[model samples]
Target: MADLKLKDLRYLVALADTRHFGRAAERSFVSQPTLSAQLKKLEDYLGVQLIERAPKRVALTAAGEEIVERARRILEASEEIVELAKGHRDPLAGQLKLALLPTIGPYLLPNVAARLRKQLPRLELMLYEYQTDPMLEKLHSGEIDVGILALPVQMDGLDSYELYKEPFTVAVPTSHKLASRQSIKVDDLAHETLLLLEDGHCLRDQALDICSGADVNEKQNFRGSSLETLRQMVAAGVGITLLPELAGRGAYGAARGVTIRPFVKPVPTRTIGAVWRKSSARREAILALAKLIEAHAL
Candidate 1:
């Protein structure tokens, strides 16, 4: 058998994750044929059949599964070694991949991205927007260095720092009865139908939790895919929805037809935080970013 290559191992791991040649190729940033050929070459070198080919689907052989498991550990360790060296040199000097919840990214990032750029000019910030669960998946898989999301999430093998407690506000159409109010109580939402993001959004769940004491009904016929969509729906006189304080700030939506009002005393809020893998070597970078976010409180 010949010596193993790390890139080939990466290709193999990508295949294992996607279970499709075309998708694996895309994940590996290679052409389908190239990835397939290298995978075949790897199998030949190892003297075993790793992948079972089929017209409709791809399946990994038992040997492929075993090797894929090992490959993942090796890849993680390899990345750790690189991260360790970079941390030693300058923890925040390299590319920092971050994923944020869609509900927060649009509203929050605009407020802090410029600051991050000015403070860590040497660090290249790569940002992505994903809903809560998928973002956590990327963080755990090491595809992203850190994640910004709602706090109290069920995180295993991850460390988190609370950045801010952002209060939730009510967004109602200007013509609605409640629109004239300066502030409303949770009971005001009783028996009201709310436009909300589709499932898989942590915001949706958080909204429901806030109204748990009240009898708030989620609109069944429609679910907004994003906060902007929900805001538009509310503006169209569809129904009221909750918006994080940042989303209601002047820069984000500030919709013409939508009236945003705060809650009365004991305001409902969500704790936003930065999360990273516990084993991550970029502690200094993560902490620095967290500090910046914490400083720019909502």
Candidate 2:
């Protein structure tokens, strides 16, 4: 450890993450030869051949792979140490990279983006929109600072705060007889054709659970890729579907021939939350974004 250099470990981590010398060099902001030479120095010092190199690609040796894993942990801890020191100075007014599940991104971002810019003038915000799995992956790898996702991510090494629960409302064609109902219940949709989003959407799963609990079958004749598509399908009398509160508002505003109804019993709802790696360095900033969203959402 007497001769260990932070630059050497950083090079190892970049190589491990990118799996290509040139790309790793790019990430580390060093020339390819400089990165390669430093890695060679590191290997020589450790008395181990860390990587098998060829003109085409690079592969890690057994010890190299093991070292890479350790390198990742070391680099993460080092970065966290720096971040923690910075956090001690100021919890806000730093770079914040955030990701959100697709279902919530479009519906929620517009409402709060301007306010965030105004409130935290010195805070730089970077946002990404992704589905559940990829969003969680980015969170784990420290590729992003925080994520807004549906509840029950249930992943290890992450802390989650439940922001709010939004109920599911039924979407029906305005001309359909059931659209006139004072309130639609799951049982009421038993005989109705139900449209749904394609698989992988958490909203679709929540909708299915609500329908199943009431002994209603979701008709799969038509599936939409997005809430807007589902609204179009409902207006076309393709089938009925359930939408979250934000989506319901859009249908009410722009979409024609679609009526939203609250269910009488067994109302469907999903909890939205802010998720960050348990080891994250910006707890205060993450919570700040969560509070902002909660305030605007309500």
Candidate 3:
């Protein structure tokens, strides 16, 4: 299989990720026709039908899925080799790919990124935003160097270090009765319909977990895709939702038409941390990033 090319494998992986030819091509920084022609050659060389092409979508065949998995390992190994060869150099000297969950990215990235520029001027940081599921999958596959997200994640081959604990606050429309309260308790949410992030966000799961056994029912048939959207809804007096402490009281705080209140003693909080594959060669850099976040995260 000397005819096999890593470039072609990357095209296939990109196709698998996006499930559309044009999107995959754009992601790979190539034209759609170039990507299509390369994959066709790859399939011919391997004697396997790797993709099932549809009019508007594409999916991997069973063999394609298996090969893509092995291809990811190969790609990650290639990266590790490059990183290892540079071991004598500064660990954070090269381009570092980092991902953050959507909920955390918007609130924390501004400050963190500004500082990363000043602190590691020689390092080029590539940032990406993803939901928890894809973020974890990329971390496991080494598609990203590290991920900053809510902790207590079930990552089998990964380790994480806590950066900070950000408490949850109740956010309601200015006219809501609870808006008059200076503080709230987890139990006080009982009988109130809570607005939460749509499914698949770790923040949503955390809210559900915190509300478990407290008899607080999530609003039926209504789910917000983001904290900002939820805040806008709250401003319009749709319903109430919980927000991270930073979103409530940090420099970016003060969304008009919403009131924020904290939980009393034993405040409900979520641990924020950086996660990376245990085998990552950039452990030192990742830990260094974690330290910076520990200092700046609220």
For residues 1-298, could you state the per-residue lDDT of candidate 3 as single tens digits? 5598989989998998999999999999999999999999999999999999988668899999999999999888988999898864888777788998888887887767788888877677789998878999998888999998888889798989999999999998899998999998888889887889888888998888888968887788988988888988889987888898887765556888999999898998999989999999888888878898899876
RMSD of 2: 14.5
Against the hidden reference, what TM-scores do the models get?
0.70, 0.68, 0.69
In model 1, the worst 10-residue window by lDDT is: 247-256
**TM-score: model 2 vs. ground truth:** 0.68
Stronger candidate by lDDT (1 vs 2) = 1
Candidate 3 accuracy as TM-score: 0.69
Best by lDDT: 1
Please provide, for model 1 over 70-137, each residue's C-alpha lDDT reduced to its tens digit, 9 standing for 90 to 100: 99999999999998977769877888898888988888877888898899878878999988889889
Clash totals for all candidate models: 0, 1, 0
Q: What is the alpha-carbon lDDT for the whole of candidate 2?
A: 0.84
In model 1, state the lDDT of residue 78: 99
In the range 1-298, model 2's lDDT, one tens digit per residue, is: 3476889989987898788999999999999999999999999899999998978878889999999888878888999999888865777878899888777888877778798888766778898988888888888889998998899987799998888888788888999888899888777887778888888787888888777756565665666788888888889888888988776774243688898888776666888999998888888888988898888874
User: Cα RMSD to native, each candidate?
Assistant: 16.8, 14.5, 18.2
- Model 1 ranges off by over 4 Å: 1-88
Reference-based lDDT, residue 170, model 3: 91
Locate the minimum summed-lDDT window of 10 residues in model 2.
245-254
Query: Which pairs clash in the backbone of model 2?
Result: 174-257
Q: Can you give the lDDT of residue 222 in candidate 1?
A: 90
